[model samples]
Target: MKKRINNHQRSTIKKVMNYIRRYWGYLGMSIVLAAVTVALTLYLPVLTGRAVDLILEKGVVDFAGILAILKKMAVIILLTAAAQWIMNACNNKITYNIIRDIRKEAFEKIERLPLKYIDGHSCGEIVSRVIADVDQFADGLLMGFTQFFTGIVTILGTLIFMLTISVKITVAVVVITPVSLLVASFIAKKTFSMFKLQSETRGEQTAFIEEMIGNQKVVQAFSHEDEALEKFDEINGRLQKCSLRAIFFSSITNPATRFVNSLVYAVVGVVGAFTAIAGGISVGQLSALLSYANQYTKPFNEISGVVTELQNALACAARVFELMEEPSEVPDAPDAVNLEEADGHVALEHVSFSYVPEQKLIEDFNLSVKPGQRVAIVGPTGCGKTTLINLLMRFYDTNSGTIRVSGVPVNDMTRKSLRNNYGMVLQETWLRSGTIRDNIVMGKPDATDEEVIAAAKASHAHSFIKRLPHGYDTVMAEDGGNLSQGQKQLLCITRVMLCLPPMLILDEATSSIDTRTEIKIQEAFAKMMKGRTSFIVAHRLSTIQEADIILVMKDGHIIEQGRHEELLAKKGFYANLYESQFVNTSSQA
Candidate 1:
């Protein structure tokens, strides 16, 4: 376990260095400034020593010499302060730039991931990595950038200046410093795993919060308030424990390092006093040695603290890197062609797939959809209806066999190009925080105002949209929260109407709309799908009564198929389903 953790820390450090390497120019400038700052600042002790010697002369006091030394001290102080300021500016720039690049790469990797990966993980977990974890990492990295470089230069500069004054004292200081380092290193090693657990638990907690927030209505509908609160308390208590444990381990580093620093200071003072008494060095020289001793040891305290914080940085960075390194969706085939203006002849040849190996969902699924064909698929929930849409859109590749569009294998076409050939509206509605016109033009960004209004009218969305304060120009709240469910569905349908791709997939497209509005939208959809190959997945048998072919699916296969009248005449599984739904509706009325 220890070996694995050490390796992980080493790997995180290596990857972090690679990211910083991209800004070598800024980093190099920061280092040079830090060196200059330290070098000039190191000479201050020497100036103080000279001033002390001049003022303590047995003869008449040489005010002239003291004044000159003071002037030099002022000049060096100004230069050192100036260099330190510029160095901090450079550090800030480098830290923020690296942070931006990391977030950009993480988000881009997420976009390139397969649907299976997203389906297998919680949205809150991914969001936490991108947001909370990145923020935590940024704090640690910025702290390092500001302190680590200057701390190293200070220690080295102070050591060299002290060596020039007295090696005997320098050796004592150096030897005692390792004790502090040993203490800090030991504590730092223990914090990494604790902090890692804290980060993971925080992500899980975020996932739960997001899940509950998104489904609060459902939770209330089911009277699950107490259960949710209990679950949340459990997660919150775990996070509190993790946080306390990590903080406890890291918090002791400062005092431990300070104690060692104080020991080093005491040794330097006692040794320098003895040396001065023996006439090995003058009083002024001894003063400079004491100052050097303080300077040299102070950084050990700071650097050790930085190291503790650095452990936290590495823990957060490992999570971010893990996300970036997830295998991206299979790259486009080397010879993949663009699917342009497809004739919409889709065929599935023995396609097999499952969300998990142990529980296969769709196996040996076969279908043939002709150009301009209107096929309606109806099935019980959890029967792999949406899974078929996922394959058709190439959101997930088939486990075996093939799915082809226009006689061309889907795998042989660039995913973007393949997806462009179809327009889809699912049961769920998604709208960005944008104006009504903006959402309508998502699939076809260059659509004109007149065309957008025409599509809205056809989708039965125009009348309500016009009633809004700004008509089509009105901005929507997040996810169109400002709109009614029926209104949101109407807007989504407007998107498909505006694009009118050669092929269409409507999965419970009008489920949220009023029955009266649904009838009008169905009329509009009928006109839109007139010459386009269309696949409608619906539970409303009445809506699909006019479909050219109605497929009854059970357990991932089409058990029965025919026109509505033909299926009813046969009195098979489809007939029984239709009869039951009709009976339920009549009884409810």
Candidate 2:
């Protein structure tokens, strides 16, 4: 079931509560412990009043009675501390466990999200929601559970205890405390919007930092350091402005409520003194009333601080929930069939699409390939060569029309199944932080050691692997940053070689390799694609000369199609493109 939360406080609160409800047993125990702690804490003041009564006159004091009261006070104090400690432990467990679940769910959501969503957002912004935002939320929620829960209980307990001592004094304290509420509420409203802006600016700053750090080499290469710093300063300045405003607004809450609290305390002291002098209450009773009044007002100070923090937490939680609740890639049909084996007859008909509605990229695009044809797609940049392959793999569904594999509409097949039948080697390689063998076995984890070595040899990567200290077992730096670009591309090819799927999509797969290795890889690919369907997207026209069919694409349309010789014979766009590459190469030579 797809669950969406409306952008309203009530709905957000409801969702937060739903998470808490999962750990209700611990929450219930924490609340019960809080109540017990408050009860003992409130009673200790009463015992102190009793001890004071016994010692009003030094010579007339009943030492035995005073001693008994002191002992009781000590026990109550100990129990109160114990209960509070236990409650805090429970709060930490609940808060962090919820954080763990939220992060897990957020990552799983990222996996299922459409490519359009991933393409639209910055990596650091998404990371902020999962890591920084969730951590902030956990801190605020822990505060709410630890102090906010017990603070309210303490306030209520003190009120009841105060009323028992003298209703007039209690009434006086009550009348003055609402002023604290008014102050806190006013500050809280202003802080919420300020904190929301602060959270957003923080995400932008994080994204900018990640971008600059990840591409530091490029920034240095093009002498973009100064410009990048100026941009960074601009973002940093905005973040500082938002953070200062949020802090300024929320900082007023505690002191404003504290001032009102002092007023309540002043009233209690003055009223209780009058009551003591008038015999309306004994000296000891008046002292207890004053203690209860302080206790009652203390919660306002704590809760005001909590409310300010909760505003920021709520803002962060909103971002995390938005990420988790985003509609995932359109789900496959309930009865979607899995293509265990495919003969690789692929077709696209009347395909029209665009990243944005106002601009079209591919329109009325049509293509058909037989079971074992080797098709090469050549195009200038932004002519929809890669986009066509993305469509074929169902990365982004076409705006209109249908793509099919083995005569089955892709929509009717499970994405995993459709992707499983095709081995893809993109120009941009991805390698995780693991052994070389691990990266190679990503497509076929259960492949035997011999299979892995054979694939590496076929892709000309075996010699490099042998030279490494630990061969295939050596772990890689993140994304294989330790290897040369050509070496990385070879490993990517090695990975696909192991998969040996019925179909293949090689998008500039050999663009990074040297000419010497390129020939070796071409020979390997030729043998590999002998009886399987293949789609090769390339810019170097010479590399694909032997392809069975050449598709020359321009402006999302196939302007020329035939064998390399036939296309050159026509002297069209393909002829000029093929000829221009050699002209540039000869000039460079």
Candidate 3:
């Protein structure tokens, strides 16, 4: 497992490097400026030591010479600061640009991903990958470029200067430095898994919150508030524990490395004093060597701190990469043809399908509808009615056999072109946060206002819409929260009415509306269905009495089929279903 994790981390790092390569100009400039800054910083101590030596040699202050050297050092320090500022600016540009591209690609990946992937993952988890994880990755890269680059340069440059002063002291510093490295490595190894766990728990918590908020009405309706709170607390407690472990380990790395660095500094100071007194090295050289020793150890402390952050960032990156790596939907065949001007003829030949391999939901499903025919399908729950619609729309391809529109196999036609011929309104209405007019025109983007209002009126939606605050221009809340369920359903139907495709599939589309409103909508539907191929999945048997053909399904097979009157006359499955519904309606009345 550890090896596999390391491989994933390495792959993510390589991908990040490829993004960096695109902005090589900015990176190259930042590197050059960082090097210049480090050089100037190291030279400042040398200049100070030289000034001290001049005063010691003469045993009298050379004020003019001292003043000139001090001035030069100040100028160099200012230039170093300026270069550091420019380097940081460049680093920010590179970091954010790469982050933008990463986010763009991740979103595009979501667009191309199959419905299967979306169905299996929680919305909050995917959202975390795109937003939170990407943000963390960007921040880490910014710190790495700004601090990591300069820290390494400072360490190497200071070591070189120390070596020129005295090889013995430099060797001691090098030997002691490894202790800090070992401590950082040990802490990082212990804490990396903790950070990864924390990230996972955080995503879980986020997902739970999103689910709860989305279904808050359901929870309240069922008086499940206490249960919801308990579940949230459990998830929150797990996240807190994971976070504490990660923070505890990360916090120890810096101070532990700093303690070892202090020991190195003490050794350097003591050894330099002895050498200076023994006439092995000058006082001025000793001063410079001491400064270099401090500079050399500083990077170790800074790097140790950054290692903790980088580990957490890598954990976030791993999650984002996991999302990006999911298998996308299969591409269309090379010779796929366009489904132009469909004649509304649909057929399913020996079609078989399953959401999972072990549990088949549709099997040997065969159906044929001539042009301009109205068909209604009725079945018990879990009898594959909706699954049939899914297969027809090519949202999920059949496991075997063929579904064809106008005698052309669905797989042989481009999915976009094939779907364009059908307009669908589902039981669960979906509306975005937009004006009423915008939602209605979604299916027909270039639709005129007059056409949109006309469609709304036909669906019996225009009257209520006009009573809203802004009429057709009224803006809806997310998922049409401001509208009643029935109103939302009407808008969905209005959207389909605007599209006016050659074929229609209505899956309990009028389930939310009252009987009176439903009757009105049904009257409109009757006229609309005249010249179109329509498939209705209805639970209320009365709605389909006028349908040209009715299919009664059970256990993934069509057990009965005929006109509603014919099926009733057969006294079989369809007759039993109709009688049950009729008796239930009578009881309710």
Candidate 3 positional error at 214, Å: 0.6
Per-residue lDDT tens digits of candidate 3, residues 385-470?
Answer: 99999999998989999998999999999989888999999999999999999999887899998999899999999999999999
lDDT of each: 0.91, 0.90, 0.91
Q: Candidate 1: misplaced stretches above 4 Å? A: 57-60, 587-589
What TM-score fits each model?
0.98, 0.97, 0.97
Give me the displacement of residue 132 in model 2, in angstroms: 0.6
Q: Per-residue lDDT for 401-424 in model 1, tens only?
A: 999999999999999998899999
Q: Which stretches of model 2 miss by more than 4 angstroms? A: 1-7, 587-589
| 313-397 per-residue lDDT for model 2 (tens digits) | 8878888998999999999999999999889899999989888999879999889999989999998999999989999899999
Q: Candidate 3: which stretches are off by over 4 Å? A: 57-59
Best by lDDT: 1
User: How many Å off is the CA of 311 in candidate 1?
Assistant: 0.9
Q: Which of the two candidates, 2 or 3, achieves a greater TM-score against the reference?
A: 2
> Model 3's lDDT to the true fold?
0.91
- Give, for candidate 3, the lowest lDDT window spanning 10 residues: 54-63
